[model samples]
Target: MPGQVTLELDPSLFGEREKRVAHSGKLVATAFRYKSGVAGLRVDNGAGTVTLLPFQGQQVWDAVFFGRSLTMKSMFDEPQPTRDYLRTYGALFLHCGGTSMGNPGPTDTHPLHGELPNLPHTDAQLVFGEDEAGAYLDLTGIARDAKAFHHDFVSRPRVRIREGATSLDMAVDVENRAGKPLPFLYLAHINFRPVDGAVLIDSVRDDRADATVRQPHLAQDEDEAVVAYHRAIAADPSSHRTLKAGVPIQPELVQTMKAAGAADGWTHALQRHPNGSGDFVSWRPDDLPYAVRWLTRGPDQDALGLVLPATAAPDGLAAATANRQIVWVAPGAAYRTSFRFGALDPAAANGLEATIKTIRGG
Candidate 1:
């Protein structure tokens, strides 16, 4: 059986000099606190390091492999202890949704991307164990979202890293406490920093004709250039696959795609850089039927969000309901999803490209 240790949130225990808490072979787990008083956990698996914010919805703040950072560049330098999404929006991997997800409609009142991101967790711990593959370390936390006499649910999010590995695995389970069927929506907002001249390989067709553009509701004061760009993508959805330097894909360009799974029922996506390095993600299409491609390039912020797996599009509650995309969980039942994100070396990147080609029946 795996052993668990409750994390002690004492400031002194996690000071700048006293961060390391546990060590086994080449794996090390450390707990620390940000200057803003938010608690965080960091794990180093010899090849890379990942910092997780256990207090703030267990979001991944940073991931570095072989001296290359995988996290996107944002205006904010550190995570803030606020509920405002924009203020604390910088994360490598952000979990979005609960009962409702996405931007609220004209009559909807839920916050943007639901109430999961930046929501504080009630408890957190470290779980360590060894399996057939090897030794592993896990950082787990409990988060709940409820209202007075309304929908109530709990979510347990975990991040795991194995010895001397460059990859990270994420899993979450959400259980409904309400006595009736509970509506649910979820999106894994895995953001990767843009690398110029990187080729995107995914389960979707390489051509633009196979994609569908989803226009988000823009404000009256939205930039005209952005609006025009959206129109361009809507006119030709296939033109949004490649990443070019200095070419602005401002605001955001979102496209809905029908993912093609491999023999094992999992879909793979990779952003292979010009230098033969890459970043990849893998998930089961059955667990998340919809794949959304999000891209935003600006002077202050740049993100290449490839293959954002979700139950439905982020078009708010009314639109999802109208489209019949809402997933319902029975009373006392749970909804679960898992995915993998990692950095790939030259050989690994080439191997993945070949595997992707095979999956595409090339």
Candidate 2:
């Protein structure tokens, strides 16, 4: 059980804005809404709309584009998409799998993905401002993961979205508030509904697994999941045997992957839309050296996830720590990282390669 604590909202720490502590009304700024077992917040940055669960890992539950939403509504049975059912029911709470992702074996009782996703967040504040670059909304939140007499860690997340920008930027600082050193594994789970013609592409070769788990062909409005394991460390995301097709996840069924061993030099990954539109995710490789791709392509509970991890793998605390893949923070030290997600629809006549190179500025 984690203890609760209050925190101050420091707009000044973010540095100078083009205007004063500029603010916007909820219509154009940020608003907090109530949802089942959690509090949902929406940020409308003029160019796009982002709805997230502030108390629940600040998970970005929905990304609305044009008129359709780009995220999955977890309950597969419901054909219609609505916020009420999503907030109250099981929606994708995408976040970093606590210290790991895999089964930690029987000795450890931690469930898949660790304690971070299910834990609640606290001390939240929303602010809007503009700089010379653009208008933006910023959400500041503080939360903790701890046991009654064990480790206590606090994470401060600064999420920003700019006006006229299709992407979201998140910078989080995590610290060990406890008295002893802490070992940790971290992975970001950003899930989106499968879009027609959407494919995953990356800059580096992947180190993939040898094991494969195939799924059944599902009809529209049906749900299923299977994972393909990568036993060897290869090149990057694109090289994994399961992803060699380089095609958008089949929209007809559910699919998932658990591959590890990331490579260097690549800073971003791209998901291209059939209409020539696409999404790009960029991060500091030093902070997030690894990544994972999960496509819950079930027509009923559709979600295409691009997981960027701060460790080598999402296996679990015991496995990662044992392999020296987990990062350790001293009692008085802090760990920090940031990543950006945005979309681009270049007018180029080039294919996926050209689209990818343009997004990454290669």
Candidate 3:
């Protein structure tokens, strides 16, 4: 018995942009026919919008602005790979890994699930969940082994919107619907493209890490010193038994956040300017702790989608847990977390500093 709302999208907004079925107004996922084989998501609550490029050789892609497109050929730099089922971006929710428990797979293979490696106990799922309302997905008979979809590969998720409003409120339910005791990791992979000067603001860390190079295998490079630091944290008994801090704001990354209406490089925090509308917000889940930051800046950056991952765990589940960065949940349990996205003109407003103070109640 949760309150719901619907999403409204203008097809004309992006010509040839195919629209997905709008359930109860919580989400409207759109696909561009003539563009980069990308899809965009519009949540009902003004929480902010996200875009995904399923064909851009990446698992996820995101952006704040709309209408901009990248060429498919320009993206992968090769002829069309398998146009068949390329697992681009969409909300990914499932128990993925190649292990049972106690032992986990390598960080690179963490997202891919199977048996044999005896991966760590990890569960990761992403779906719009309830704020102050109730649950979103009606988990009346969701079987743990049940295929996410009936016949169609894409999940036919359900949602509802009460009155016609510009915003949306939805629910996402996670339970131990599986028969066996399930161990897993959950995350909302909100991917964002890093435009030059695009400052990312989050307080998920107590101490700021100098901008680290993002390696393909892990969130950060495999520096001997960094690995040693992680090992030390893992050995600490006073920590939370996970590798996350959960601080949602950072000033150094902000210096790297790029401005809007740009073609390359990074943007400083989007201040309320004479011509700009500053809007940014995030969540502070008590369970998840570590936050991730990433940006792939290059001439073909647009062709290659980037991820400024704001995570609650560092690296993979095993590493994260070792560092005391895990969210423990009781069996047959349910919880909710939410954030807001709105305008805060930095020039006219208190700038990024004022906005952070407002969000943190500082």
Estimate TM-scores for all models. Answer: 0.92, 0.70, 0.45
Report the lDDT tens digits of candidate 2 across residue range 251-272: 3221223322224433666666
- CA lDDT of every candidate: 0.82, 0.54, 0.29
Tell me the number of clashing residue pairs for each predicted model. Answer: 1, 14, 72
Q: Give the clash count for model 3.
A: 72
Return the lDDT, model 2, position 206. Answer: 23
- Model 1 regions more than 4 Å off: 2-12, 16-18, 206-210, 216-232
Evaluate model 2: give its lDDT: 0.54
Q: Candidate 1 lDDT, tens digit per residue, 306-348?
A: 8788898887888788899998999999999999888899999
Lowest lDDT 10-residue stretch of candidate 2: 226-235
Better of 2 and 3 by lDDT: 2
Question: lDDT value for candidate 3?
Answer: 0.29
- The C-alpha stretches of model 3 lying farther than 4 A from their native spots are 1-109, 112-171, 179-181, 204-279, 299-311, 340-353, 358-362
